[model samples]
Target: MRRKKLFKMAEVLTFENVFRDPTVIFGKWKEFFGNDNDIVLEVGCGRGEYVIGLSEVYPERNFVGLEMKGSRIWPGAKKMLAEERKNVSFINTMVKNVFDFFGEGELSEIWVTFPDPQPKPCRAMKRLISPRHLEMYKKLLKKGGKLHFKTDNTMLFDYGVEVVGADKDFEVEVVEYDLYSTEDRADLAEAKLVQTYYEGKFSALGEKIKYLRAKI
Candidate 1:
């Protein structure tokens, strides 16, 4: 099993849609995707469930999955290749280096689905929704762009709402402590369009999904 995974990890970068060299596509995303369509990013996209789903739902918009683990990227890259999805791409890198691959206001939307939450106090800054990360996201997002955050962690959810709501630069458009509690609305429809791998596990364990939508 380990050998198979290692082989897949090594093969991840070989896919036509997977890019490890930021210089090759940085500031040339439209050329990379061969279209001027808006680009959306899914941070820490494990196995590429959300990105893949969104790509199917919104074919007009390009989708990129940013995940650090090459092994974690293997399955998604392989599946996308098999399906011949032209609008999807994968970047194997940490979120801190996002600027290396994208220019300011380059992305139309961003998604943070089931991130680690960086629960430790000392690792607070490591959280995807942390203030520093929010700044990075704000810079990368185009004017009128939006970011969607979904998680099952109560503490992280509250922290995101508090910090994002308090920030004067951003507007917290919607906050749902239990996303599945009601029928999906047009405002937050994408959050329920697909179930991510971890989201499925948490939902099966009777955990209520928390969702936050903020405009930058």
Candidate 2:
């Protein structure tokens, strides 16, 4: 497994659209994509499912997947390179360093898909939707930009909703404990459109996906 991971890491380094240096593209995302289109970010994008899927759906917009593990990002990065996708890219970095990856008000949307719950009380601040991360999102995302969260863990969902709801800077737009159970509508189309690898596994095991969207 270690050898396979090393190979994937090496292969990811060769992809033209995969970036290792966040400083290089800090405020030049439009120049990198060669367009002034709006950019969206997907945090913890395993295998780039959401990024690839959203790119196909919204070709007019650019999508960037941020994941620290290159092995998990190999399949998606390879597909984007093979297909010559211009609006999709991958960033090899941790979420904690996201503030340095993009300029202020640079992103139009942000997605936190099936992230680790960090359930313990001591680890609560580590969750992607924690108060500290929300502040970072507020700084990087444009005014009124949306932040979407999806997970199979109830505790995390409730915690996220509470935190975002309490923040005066954010307005909670949507909160669904069971995404698919509700009536299908245009507002929920994006979240309904893509199912990440872990999302599929959790759904198969009878877990109801929890989703929340907030505008900052």
- lDDT per residue, candidate 2, 148-197, as tens digits? 99999999999999999999999999999999998979999999999999
List TM-score per model, in order: 0.97, 0.97
Model 2, runs deviating above 4 Å: none
Candidate 1 per-residue lDDT over residues 1-216, each given as its tens digit: 699878878899888888888988888888878899999999999899999999998999999999998899888888988998989999999999999999999999999999897888899999999889899999999999999999999999998998788877788898999998967588878988989999999999999999999998
* Top candidate (lDDT): 2
Off by over 4 Å in 1: none
- In terms of lDDT, the poorest run of 10 residues in model 2 is 21-30
Per-residue error at 210 for model 1, in Å?
Answer: 0.5
Task: After the best TM-score superposition of candidate 2, give how far the Cα of residue 82 lies from its true spot, in angstroms.
Answer: 0.2
The Cα error of candidate 1 at residue 7, in Å, is 1.1
Candidate 1 similarity to native, TM-score: 0.97
